[model samples]
Every structure is written in C-alpha cells, then in structure tokens.
Target chain A: MIDVQNITKRYGHHTAIDQVTFSVAKGEVLAFLGPNGAGKTTTMRILTCFMPATEGSARVAGFDCTEQPLEVKRQIGYLPETPPVYQELTVTEYLTFVGRLRGITGPKLSSALDQSIGRLELGSVRHRLIGNLSRGYRQRVGLAQALLHDPPVLILDEPTVGLDPKQIIEIRELIRSLAGSHSVILSTHILPEATAVCQRVVIINKGHIVAEDTPEQLSARLRQSEKVSITLKTCPPDCEMKLRAIPGILNVLPGQAGGSFLIECELGRDLRDEIARVAVLSQWGLLELRTVSMTLEDVFLRLTRHEDHLSEPAEATVSASAERTDA
Target chain B: MTPVQAVIAKELRGYFVSPIVYVVGAVFLLIFGLLSYLYVGFAGAQAIQLMQMQGGMAQINLNDLVFRNLFASMRIVLVIILPILTMRLFAEERKLRTFEFLMTSPIRITDIVVGKFVSVFLIYLGLVALTTLVPTVLMLFSDFDWNPIWTGYLGMVLLGALFLSVGVFASALTENQIVAAFVSFGMLLTIWLIAGLGNLFGDTTAGRIISYFSYMEHYDRLLRGLIDTSDLVYFGSGLALMLFLTHRVVESTRWK
Candidate 1:
C-alpha cells in the first residue's frame, strides 16, 4: 500500500515532479507509463525515500517516507533503473549481502535467496561475477536482489528494459503472476507492458499526471470519434461527398488502397449498418468493411503529445488500430 | 550480521578483491622494509667506525639510531599511500550508483560511515602490523628498550587514524576517486605545512596556538614515548572532528 499526495520535487528552478498524487492498493499492480524524463523515476524515488519531496508527502505501508524512511524502506523492495549492484560480487554473494542488509538471516536468508534466484531463474549464473555476466543477466540479478527480501511493496523502474523478446515475455508473465500477492508499481515507456501486466495505468508527462485508468478504459476514454474503413472494388468519384453528406458521418478520408475510404463518425455510434445499406444502394462494390477503434498507443500519444495526434491522416488511425490486435 | 558488521564485512571483502589494496600494501611494506634495512646498515657502519677510532663496542641505541627515524620516514609513506587506499571507499559507491542502494536500505548513515572507516583502518592496521616483524627480528640479535618502539607504533596509529578520517571526508565530497585522493592529499599537506609557518613566530602565543593545531608536535611526543594526555586529546579531538564532518557530508548527500 502506498499513497502520494501532491508531492512536488524541484531541483532549483527545474521541477522534476510537480504536485503528483497517486495511490496503490494492496496487491494491485500499477504501471507508471511515461516517456524518458517524464518524472516517473522522480516520483518513485520520493516514494522509496531515496530523496525527500520538495513539498507534500508520500506514505508507504502507513509510514511517512520522509519521517519514517526506515519503516517505509522495510516495506519496499526497490530495483532502480540502473540495477544497483556491485560489479565484483557474484550473484549469490550479492543476494546474501542484500538479505543480511534486510535483517534476514540463517535458514530464512537462504530460503529467501533461493526463492528469489529461482523466480528470476538466476541459479545457473549464481556463482559467476556480475561484471562478467551479460546485461540481461545483470538486470535479472537486480530483480533477484529486490525480490529476495520479499517485502510487501515492489517499486521497479523499467524492469524489462534490456531483456530479449523471450525474456521480456517471461518477465511480463512473472509480473502478471505477482498480482494479488505483491503491490507492484512498475514504470515503463513500453505501452504493451502496461497493457499486459498492470491493473491500472498512470500516464505522466512533463511532471504531471496526464491520464490514469485501466488499459482498456484509457483507450476508450480518449476516443473522440469512431471510424469505419471500407474498400470498394469499383471506382467511386462522388462516394467521398456522399459519405460526408450522410447524417452521422463526421468526415471521409482516404484509406490504405486506391478505392478504399475511411469514414469518421461521432463517438459511441456504430454506423456499419448505414454504411452497408449505402454501399448496397450505391453498388460501390464493398470488398471489405470494418470499424476502427483507437488503441492504447493512440491514447498515449494523444495525452502525452499534441492532442490533435489522432486526427492526423487516417492512415495513422488505421495503423494504430492495426497495432491494437498485436497487443 | 548487524547493520554495521554487515557493511564492514562487505567493505573488507571489496578491498581484498580490488588491486588497489595489494598494490598499496606492497608499496607500503616495501618502503618500511627498505628504510629499516638502510637504517640497520647505517647503524652497523657507525658502530664499526666507533670501534676502530676509540673504543670497545661503542653504544648504538637502535631506538635512537633506527626505529625513531624509521617511524619518522613512514609519515611520508602513510600520507602518500593511505589516500590511495581510502579514495574508493565512498566515491566508488557514488559513481556506481550503489549509494542509492545503501541509503534506501534500513541501515543508518552513521553505521555505513563507521563501517567503511573501520574496515579500511583494519587493512591499514594489518599493513602497519606487518612492519613490526622487522623490529621483532632485530630484538632477537640486539638489546634495546621496547617502550619507544611501541610508542612509535602508537604514534603511527594515531597519525594514520587522523589521515584516514580526512580521507573519508574528502571521498564523501566527490564521486571521482582521483579527485578525492588529490583533495585529501592537498588538505593533509596543507595542515602539516602549517607547523612550518608557525615556527616563523618563534614562541609567540599565536605561534604556539597555531602550531598546536598541526599534528607534528603531538606525534613527536608520542614517538619519544612521552604519552602526554594533551597529545592524546589532540588526536582524539581531531579524529572526532573529521568523523563528525564526514557524517554531515554523508547525511547531506541524499539531499543533493
């Protein structure tokens, strides 16, 4: 459990995070979705008590981070962006150090170490020096260090940044399996990671929380219009104007192919029936037809970047919707 | 392990793994050994010449002839080499970003600072203790009072503790090890040089007070086996001051 209330962090005149407020319930995995330098790491640092916020407060496990850092730290297992590991230490040695630092010892320490190493699948390289290991393995060692203490809260900053595709999938599956047992707050720029593993997403940009919702709800909330994409085999010179003249059709734009057209309509309106009837009466050869919904990527781009991002060429929307099924 | 003991163990393990400790230790021992050998040879020649000139086995006090000078010469060696040992203590952690790991943990800042200081001090102690082997062997072949030799070692220990405190303070100021080493070197050199300037005043109260701030007088007294409480107070207060300043720097680092 964590609660951050209007915490602002400023380094002189430059504010890293401004009045950011968010909370995580027990066993809920929250995604901190943001691009680079978007105050995600800053918020996490304030929560972890590495640094105090310039104003306001953050509490972890009912203890104030600034005033009761030791207690808050006792509840948290943090994996910083760079994976704070000693290069000369072996994986098992490093984990043992962390475990002892956490006050776990004897059989308990070994069990915690074994459980974390097994979870991260680091048993093969346990005896190898961390500096000699590959970056992915080092990252996994970082993960193992954080998990070894088995704290109530886990704050991971870009946990899957350097892993391979299979490793990424494995890490995502591991995070997904942590639900209902760990309160995980993972920050990542990769939108699919949030979609795959998180129960709630908090999108931060320029030191502000731009949007916060479930993955599906985030996309649905940002949708200003619905779209219908159709491809006609026959030539249609006046088809664009006719579709624009329709009652609920917002606008008609070019689709992928030559005879293809994209029709934009008001939100929550499924104009497929009207489009189909018009295609039958006009006999404009309906080769293929489908409705396009905005994807999480489009929602992210719209909220973080220029709001008019989605209203660009219809091809952008088409590709965005095409990416939806990929996730 | 307790928080402080765990950090000390980790730090000691770190020193042994790095090449800095071995290189610095070898150089320190080599200097001690070479100086001890040269003093012994020089003492032997003096005794032989004295016998040839006037007498039957003229007196050559090894403490005055060898151990005193040996201990004096080691001040320079410790000032130069000790910084190399301590430069990486806090600076390397800052550069590697492991500082965040330590700070975010449940350990107190004082525990970490004291742990690192004691760990390096133990390594230095081991190196200094190794030099005692030379005197230990010399004692078997000759007769000399052991009091001054032990006091000289006590002087070296106090002087080194002061040097290491300054080193820990300097290392806390920056993330660059070379810069840390040099800053400490400059500070120690400047403090030692203060005594030279104080002598310009020649027994004036200001000169006496200024010279008292430097370590040379107290260390000299200890080297001669005087063991005054003032000298002990001087080393104790100096070490405490440096450690307190180091604690402040470490505590303020999280804010920065």
Candidate 2:
C-alpha cells in the first residue's frame, strides 16, 4: 500500500511536482500517465524514498518514506528508467547482489533468485554478462532484479519503454499478473499500456495531476456526446438533414466512405434505434449502424489539451467534448 | 550478509572481474621490484666501500638503507596509484547511474562509503603485502632489525588507507573518473608539499601546525620504529575525517 499526500518537489525556482497526490491500495495496479517532463519520475522517486519531497509526506506499506526509509525500502522493488544494472556482472550475479542488499540470504535468497529468473524467463541468459545482452533482455533483467527480493510493492518507471512489441506484451502480461500480489505503480507515456495493465490511471501534466480514475470512467467522463456511424445502401441529398432532424442529434457529417454518415448526439442520448426506424420509414436502406466509444487515447489528449489551455482565460471554458464533436 | 558486507563483496568482485585489479597489481609490483632492486644495489655498494676502506666487516643496517626508502617510494607510488584504484569506486557508480540503485537501497550512506573504502583499502593492502617479498628476499641474504621493518609497513598501511579515503572523497565529488583522479592527486600533492612549507617557515607556530598536518611527518616517525600514540591518532582521525566527508558528499547528492 502507498499513500502520497500533496507532495511537492522543487528545485530552486522550478517545481518538479506541484502538490501532486495519489495512492495505491494493496494489491492494486495504478498506472501513472504523463508526457515527458510531466514529473512522473520525480513523483515515483519520492514515493520510493529515493529522494525527499520538498513539502509533504509519503508512506509505503504504512511506513513513512522519510521517517522510515529503510523500512519502506525493504518493501519496495524499484526499477528506475535506466535499469540500475552493472554491465560487467552477469544476470544471476546482479540479482544475487540485489537480493543480498535487501537482506534476503541463504535459502530464501536462492529461492527468490530462482523465482525471479524463472518469472522473467532469464534462464538462458542467467550466466551471460548483462552488457552482452540485448536491450529487451537487459530490461527483463532489470525487472528480474526488482522481483528478486519479492517485495510487496513495485514502482517501475516505464518498464516497457525499450522493448519490442512481443516483449511489451510479455511484460504487460507479467505486470498484469502482479496486480493481486504486488501493489504496482508504473509510469508511462504510453496510453494503451495503462489501459492494458493498470486498473486505475493517474494523468499528470506539467507537475499537476490533471485527472485520476478508472480508464473506463475517465473515457466516459470526458465523453460529452455519443457518436454513431451509419451506412446506407443508397445516398440521398437529404440524409444529413434527416439525421439532424432526429431528437437529441447535434450534427450529422458524411463519413469517409460513400453513403455513410457519422452522427453526433447529445450526452446520454441513444439515436441508433431512432435512426434505424427513420431510415426504414424513409426508404434510406440502412446497411449498418454502430455506436463509437472514445478510446483512452482520446481521453488522455482531451485532458492534457484542456490543461494546456488553462493559461488562456477566455478560451478555458471551451469544453474539450464540445471541441471534439464540433471538429 | 550485512548490507555493508554485501557492498564490499560486490565492490571487490567488481575490482577483480575488471582488468583494473590485475593491471594495477602488476604495475604496482613492477614499481616496487625496481625500487627495491635499486635500493639494495646502493646499500650493497655502500657496504662494500666501507669494508674496503676499514679492512673489516662494515655494520650496515639494510632495513634502514633499503626498507625505509622502499616504503618512502611506496608512499609516493601509492599517492599516484591509489587514486587510480579508488577513482571508480563512486565515480563509476555515478557515471553508470548505479548510484541511484545504491542510494535507494536500504543501506546507510556510511555503509556505502565505508564498504567502498575498505574494499579499496584491502586491495592496497594486498599490493603492499606483495612488496613484502622484497624484505623476505633481503632476509635470505642479510640479517637486519625487524622492528623498523614492521613499523615501516604499519606506516605504509596507515598512509595508504589515508590516501584511499582521500581518493574516495575525490571520487564522490565528480562522476568523471579522470577528474576524480586528478583532484585526488592535487589534494595529496598539497598535503605532501605542506612539509616543504614547514621547512620554509622553520619552527614558527604556523609552520608547526602546517607540518603537523603533513602526513610525511607522522609517517617518518613511524618509519624509524617509533610508533607514537599521537601518530596513530593523526592517521586514525585523518582517515575518519576523509571517510566522513565522503559520506556527507554521498548523502548530499540524494537531496540534490
């Protein structure tokens, strides 16, 4: 479990994180989403007790990070962006060293080492020098190092950054499997990574937490209107007018394909049935009708774009959803 | 294993697995051998000259003529070599970004500093031990007092340990190994040159204080087989001070 309360990290006149706050319940996976320079790594560093927050407090596994750093460190498995590996040492040697540093020894250390190696599938490269391994293998070794002590919490900063697509999926599945046993807080700029592996998403932009919620909730909350795509067997000049005349329909625009249209309706409105009935009555010969939901990527861009406009007072009230449907 | 022990073990393994230990070790032995050979040759020539003039056996203290000078040369060699040995201790960690891993671990800053200091100290000790073969070979050919020889070795170990702490401190000041080496070299050179400043100032109060700070003054006393408590205190406190400063530097880095 982790609790961070209004932690602010400042460097002279620059604030890396401004009153940013979030927490992860035990056995929960929280994705930290932010663009580059969003202070995601800074926040994770403070939570891991790697650096002290200029103001505020953080606790991991109920141990205060600053007051009880060693205790907090004992319960955390951190994989920094650089992997924190010794290029000269072999994979097993590096993991063994990390295991010992965490106070795991003898039979327990051996078992933990084997478990990490097996879990990360590092058996083939176990005896190879880390410097000789590929980037994907090196990343896996970094993950293996974190899992060596079997700590209850994992704070990984972009764990899948350099991996290939298959490696990314494998790591995603690995992190997903860790949800019920280890509370994970992984930071990444990749929107789909959060949707795939994390239960909750915290979107931070420019040192501020812009949004936090479940992925679905964030998508739904940011979606101000519904969109429906309808395809007709034949095109009519009045098709757009007919769709716009329907109740709750805001706008109807031609789709990229011929005889198809994209309809925008007011929030919480279902125009599919009405459009289908109207098409049948008017002899429009409807071929397909489907509702389109906003993806997590759309929600992320909307939230970040909204934050970007906070500096311009007059345009600040222009809702992200309004701009989306109008565009 | 304890955290400190684990760090020390890992550091030592790092030293051995790389070419640094072997390369430095070979160069150290070569320098010691050449210095010992020259000293033994000069001492032997002096003894032969004395015998020829007196028409009898000349009393020559080989330990005085050879071992003392050998250690003095060793002190200078250590000043040059110990920095090379210790430059990577902390600087390499910073360069490779492993300092994050080390600092974030559950270990204390003192443990990291002390572990690094001790590992390098042990390697220097091993190098010093290898030079003992010079004395062992001298024992085979001549008889000499062991007291000064042993004290001279004690002085070398203490002085080398002191130099290592300085090297570690210098290494902590920067991520560049070359800069660390040069900074430590400059620092030790300043300390060594303080003895000359003492000579220039004579017996003035300022000169006395400066000379007291000179590591050579304390080391000279030990080389003569006089192990004063004050000398031990000087080396002990100086070593501690350097290590403590290194710890402070390392701890301060986390805040920055």
Candidate 3:
C-alpha cells in the first residue's frame, strides 16, 4: 500500500513533478504512464525512499517516507533504473548479500535466494559472475535481489527498458504472476506494457496526472453523447445539408461512407427516430448508424494536452450553460 | 550473514582477487630484499666488518644483525608500500560504481568503512610478515638479539596501520586513486617532517608540542627496544582520528 499526496520535486528552477497525488490499494498493480521527462522515475524514487520529495509527503505501508524512511525501505523492494548491481559478484552471492542486508539469515536466506533465482529463472547463471552475464540475465538478477526479502511492495522503474522482446515478455509474465501477492507500482512510458499488466493506469504529462481510470472507463469518458454517425446506402445529394436543417439538429458533417453523415443534436435529444422518419420518407436506406467514440489514446492526448473540454458540447453549452445559468 | 560479516567477507574476497594487492606485495618484498641484503649488503658487509675487526670478529654481534636490518628495511619499505596498498581501498570501489550498491544496502556505514580498512590492513600485515625471513635468515648464521627485532617489527606494523588508516580516509574523500595516493603520501610526508620542523624553533613548549606529533621520532625510539607510552598514544591517536574521519566520509556519501 502506498499514499503520495501533493508531491512535488523541484531541482533549482525546474520542476520535475508538480503537485502529483495518487495512491495504490493493497495487492493492486498500478502502472504509472508518462512521456519522457514526465517525472515518472522521480515519483517512483520518492515512493521507494531512494530520494526525498522536494515538497509534500509520501507514505509506504503506512510509514512516512521522510520521517520513517528505514521502515518504509524495509517494507518495499526497489529495482532502480540502473539495477544497482555489483558486476564482480555471482548471482547467488549477490542475492545472498542482499538478503543478509535485508535481515534474512540462515535457512531462510538460502531458501529466499533459491526462490528468487528460481522465480526469476536465474538458476543457469547462479554460479557465473554478474559481469559476464548478458543484459537480460543481469536484469533478472536485479529483480531477484529486490524480491529476495519478499517485501510486500515492489517499486520498479523501467524494469524492461533495454531488454529484447523475448526478455521483456518474460519479465512481464513474471510481474503479472505477482498480481495478488504483491502490490506493484511500476513506471513506464510503454503504453501496451502497462495495459497488459496493470488493472488501472495513471497517465501523467508535464509532471501532473492528466487522467486515472480503468482503460475502458477512460475510453468511455471521452466519447461524445447524443451524437450519431449515419452511413446511408443511397441518399439525396443534399442529405447532409438537409439533416443540418432539421429541428434540434445542431450540426452535420459529411463522413466517409460516400453519402454518410455525422450528426450532433441538442442536449438530451436523440434524433434517431426523427432521422429514421426522414430517411424513410426520402427513400434513403440507412446502412449503418453508430455513436462516435474516443479510444484511450485519444483520451490520453486530450487530457494531457489540457484540451479535454475544448470540443465537448457540454463545454460549449456551459459557456452556454454558464450563460444559461447566469440567465 | 550479518551486514558486518557480509561486508567484511566481500571486502576480503575483493582483496584476494585483485591483482593490485599481489603486485603491491611483490614490489614491497622486492624492495625489502634489495635494501636489506644487497644495498646494505647485510651478509657481505657483516663478513667483511667482522674480518676487519681486531677483536676476532666480536662473535658477529647479534644486536647489529637483527636490529640494523629491520630498522633500515622498514624506512624504505613502508614509505613506498603503504600508499600503494591504501590508494585503491575506497577509490576503486567508487570509480567502479560498486560502492553505490554497498552504500544503498541496509548495511550501516561503519560496517563498510571498518570492513575495507581491516582488509587493507591485513594486506599490509601480510606484506610486512613476508619480510620476517630477512631476520630469520640472519638468526641461522649468527647470534642475534631477538628483542630489538620484535620491537622493530611491532613498530613497523603499527606504523603501517597508522599510514593505512590515513590512506583509507584519503581514499574515501575522492574517486581518483592517483589523487588518493598523492594526498596520502603528502600527509605522510608532513608527519615525517614534524619533528625536524620542531627543531627549527627555539625549544619552546610550542616546539615540543610540534615535535611530539612526529610519528617517526617515537617510531625511532620504539625500534631501539624502548616502548614509550607517549609514542604508543601518538600512533594510536593518529590511527583513531583517521578511522573516525573515514567513518564520517563514508557516512557523508549517503547525504549526497
């Protein structure tokens, strides 16, 4: 479990994270999505107690990060961007050392080391020095070190950044298997990776959380309402213009169906019945009719760019609604 | 393993695997051998000096064979060897970025500093112990006073300990081994000069205070089979101060 509130990191005049606030529930896998320089790593560092936040407070496992750092660190495992590896040590030696540092000992330490090596699939390179291991193997070693103590939370920063596709898939599968047992907060700019492993995504841009929701909920929230896109098989020449002239019809734009139209209507108005009446009277067959929707990517860009309300009829009517409210 | 034991074992293994440790030991042995037997001509000079004496060789005075060789050997060997041993103690770790892994681990800062210092100190001890054969060889051929040799060996080990501690502190302050070596040599040189610089004064209390600070002046008395408590305190205090400073430096790294 983690709670970060009003967290802002400023280095001199540059702000890395701007008043970001988010929390993760127990055993939940929360993916932090952001573009480059979007402060994803900075936030992860704050959560892991690797770096103090410039402003605000963060708590991990109910322990304050700044005030109770050691306790917070004791409760969470961190795989930094660079992995924090000792190249001269063997995989078993490295994990054993890490386990000892984390207060594991004797049979517990050995068993933990064995489990980590087994889980991360690092058994082949257990006796080989880390310097001779490939990038993927070294990465698994890093992950194993973090998991050796079996901490309840894992804070991984770009865990699969430089790995090949197969390695990435393997690492992802490993992370996916940690779902119910460990609470994870991973930051990555890779959209599909987050979608695959995370139940909820937090899209951040310019040091702020632009949107946070399930993928489907985010997509649904960005869809336009009371607007239907209609494609006609055979329509009159001025069908789109005619649709625009109908009462309660706000706007009509020609679409790609040769004689299709995208129609917007007044609030709480569904003109599908009226449009069907007009289409039948005009002897024009409706081939397909559906509402226009936005994908998660569109919602991500719109919210991050601060343009979410710009094209919404709700926004227009709010000026119109504010004007209406004022009237 | 406990953090302290884990750190100590890792540091010792690092020393065992590193080529620099052996190279330093070989060079130290070579210099000790050259200065003791060939340059000073320990065997030939003694044979000639004994033959030239009118007192029927004075039975090859045991004191000269044991005391003279160890005293002379230490001045040359320790001065050259300690800097090489301590130079990379912390500097190499920093340059390799392996220190970051150690620092960030849950181990205490004191454990790391003490572990590294002990490993390097052990290397110094091993190198010093290897040269004991010079005295052992002399004992086989002549009547030698073992007391002075023991005293001299103790003083040299203590001297090495003191120098290594200062070098450890210097190494912790920088990532460049060259810089650490030079800084340690400079500090050692300053300690070596303190008594002579004291002589420049008109024998005031200030002058005595300055003279008492020189490790070599006390080391010389200790080499002559006399163990002054003041000298013991001087070297002991100096080593303690450096170890403390090394701990501070190691701790300060976390803040950075």
Model 3: per-residue lDDT, tens digit, B1-256? 6777776677676677677878888888887776676633565677677778754554555455546555755775676668877888788878876665565455567777787788888778887788888778866866667887788888888888999998999999999999998898888888888878888884899888888888867888778888888888988998889999999887665444
- Writing each residue's lDDT as its tens digit, candidate 2 over B165-251 gives 999999999999999999999999999999999989999999889899989899999998999999999999999999999998998
Question: What tens-digit string does per-residue lDDT give for candidate 1 at A70-158?
Answer: 99999999999998999888899899999888899899999999999999999899998898999899899988888888888999999
RMSD (Cα, Å) of candidate 2?
3.1
TM-score of each: 0.95, 0.93, 0.80
Assess the local accuracy of residue A266 in candidate 2 as a C-alpha lDDT between 0 and 100: 91
| Candidate 3 global CA lDDT score | 0.78
Please provide, for model 1 over B61-179, each residue's C-alpha lDDT reduced to its tens digit, 9 standing for 90 to 100: 99999999999888888889888888998999999999989988888888889999999999989998998999999989999999999999999999999999999999999999999
Q: Poorest 10 consecutive residues of model 3 chain B by lDDT?
A: B57-66
Q: What is the TM-score of chain A in candidate 1?
A: 0.91
Report, for every candidate in turn, its global Cα lDDT versus the true structure.
Answer: 0.89, 0.88, 0.78
Q: What is the interface RMSD of each candidate, in Å?
A: 0.8, 1.0, 2.6
Report the lDDT of model 1 for residue B210: 89
Q: What is the DockQ of candidate 3?
A: 0.32
Model 2: DockQ score: 0.74
Better of 2 and 3 by DockQ: 2
Q: What would the DockQ be for model 1?
A: 0.78
